[model samples]
Target: MTAVQRLRSAAVLSPPLLWTVVFMFVPYSILLVYSFWKTQYPIFVPAFQLGNYMELVRDPQYLRVLLRTLKIAGLVSFFALVLAYPYAYFLVFKVKRPSVRLTLYMAVVAPLWVSYLLRAYTWKTILGTQGVLNSFLVSTGILSEPSSIFLYNQAAMVLTLTYVFIPFMVMPIYAALEKIPPSLKEASADLGENRLATFLKVTLPLSMTGIVAGFTMTFCLAFGDFIAPFLVGGPDGVMIANVIASQFGAALNWPLGSALAVVMLVIVLGIISASDRFERLGAGRLT
Candidate 1:
């Protein structure tokens, strides 16, 4: 390439490359280094050690928390997929009016405009003993008094996460569903395939890309979230993220926190990698 052309290309890429290195790579590298160090009360001893990771493996509490986090994340992803797929299909296939579709899409995405903290707290209020739901149930004579069963539990955590992340799942699936040509479905029908068979074979397979994307996104976000759990998770809802937050906060164990963070990052990356592989395989099969 000519010098001028090379200079122009470099100019185009430099800003993003620099931004990534400065913001993303550098912070991650520092966290990795911190993970290997030891914390002595208020002081961080800059010495390499695997003690943090060892403790993570040996401690049953840590393992349980990690497992719990994974389970909740998986559940959130599954539920999101179940709820989002049909809505997306309805938007793409059933909604005939362009203005109506656009309005519906905006409605689905509208929750994102509100603060996440506000949303979490809203759920907390709804699930509380004296909350609207409990009051409604009591007033209906379904219950003699308000119940404490709804708030501060794993169910609450899962419900909140699913509600919050549903839009993420919906948008991707909608995009994928919209991209599917109507001609393909018509062709399938012409070939003597029923609507159900055509959808199962063609529509569903084609939308797997969006499903995978949504699942990965929701799983990672849910797994790493500490705020929702703190708000509504109560004792049973506590996940690895809560533990990690404790290590960084009142625990003041920076090295341990960094180690936990690193481990979580590794797990998330592993999931993404597996999902990418599965996506590739599905795409190949479809083609």
Candidate 2:
């Protein structure tokens, strides 16, 4: 390339590159260093050690919390997928009017306009012992008094997370489904394949890219979520993020917290890599 062309290209890329370095790389680099340090009473000692990571594996409480976090993340992803796929499919395919489809799509994602804390607290209010659901049930003669079944549990955590992230699952899947060529479906029909068969063979496989993206995103967000648990998830819903927060908060163990944060970051990166691999394979097969 010519000097002028190269300079223009560099100018276009430099802002984003600098933004990433300053906002993303630098913070993560600091966290990486902090993770290796040791914590003495009242302070973190600058030294290389694997003690924090070791404790994560060695301690049963941390292990349990990690496993529970995984379980909740998985559940939230699954439920979000179940709810999102049909809605997205309807928006992309079933809905006939363009205006109507656009409106409906906006409705699904409109909750995002509201504050996340408000959304979480909305669920808490609905699920709490004397909250909306309980009041309705009691008033309807379904129950003698307000019940506590809906809040303060792992199930509540999963439900809250699923509701919050369903829009994340929907948007990508809607875009993927919209991108699908009608000729592919027409060709499948011409070959005497039924709608269900064609979808199973052609549509679903083609949409795997979006599915993987949404699943990976929802899982990662749900896995790291601490606020929803604080608002709606009680004792049983404590996840790895909560544990990590405790270390940084009242526990005052920065090294251990940093180590936990690093581990979570690594896991998320691993998931993203796997999702990319799957997307490449799916694309290659479709091609």
Candidate 3:
């Protein structure tokens, strides 16, 4: 390329590169630095130390919380996929009218237009001691009184997070399903394969990219979530994010908090990398 072309390219790229360096790179670098600092009494001192990260390694409680976070994230992703895929498939295949398909799709995703906090709060209200479910059950004589079983547990967190994150799963799968050509299914039918066989051999494999993407999105979101745990996941439902929040806020342990945040970032990046591989694999199968 000529100097002028190079200059033009650099100029176009400069804004985004500069923005990333300033905003994303700088903040993360600062967080990295803090992860190595030492906490002295009420304040932290600048020093190179692995004590914070080491504490995380040596701590069983942190491990347990991390494990719980993983379990919850996995469960949310699994349930979201289970729930979202069928609806997405129905919308793409079963629904004949374009207008009706759009309406149904919009209805499934309409919850996203509302505030996330409000959505989470709505679940909390529904599951609370005097919440709608309990009230209905009691009034209908299904139960003698309101039950506290619905709120403040890992199950509650899973339910709330699944509901909150289902749309993420739906959209990607829907897009993937929509991209599939009907001719492939026709060819499968011509070969005397049943519908289930065609789906297993063709549709499911082609949609793996979307499934991976949706799973990664929901899992990461659930992994880093704190609010749902705060609202519904009572004492037993404490997650890594909640622990990280306490370290930074109430505990005033910036070093530990930064280390935890860095770990979370690494794990999320690893998931994205795996999803990229799956997406490529899925796309390659079409050839």
TM-scores for all candidates: the values are 0.97, 0.96, 0.97
The list of candidate 1 runs beyond 4 A from truth reads: none
**Cand. 2 TM to true fold:** 0.96
Worst 10 residues of 3 by lDDT: 278-287
For residues 122-182, write the lDDT of model 2, one tens digit per residue. Answer: 9998999999999999999999988898999888888889999899999889988998999
C-alpha lDDT (0 to 100) for residue 98 of candidate 1: 94
Residue runs of model 3 more than 4 Å from their true location after superposition: 284-287
lDDT of all the models against the reference? 0.91, 0.90, 0.92
lDDT of 3 at 190: 99
Candidate 1 lDDT tens digits, 1-287? 99999999999999999999999999999999999999885668898989999988888999898999999999999999999999899999999999999999888899999999999999988999999899999999999999999999999999999999899999989988899888989999999999999999889999999999899999999999999888998777788888888888888888999999999999999999999998888872453
> How many pairs collide in each candidate, listed in order?
0, 0, 0
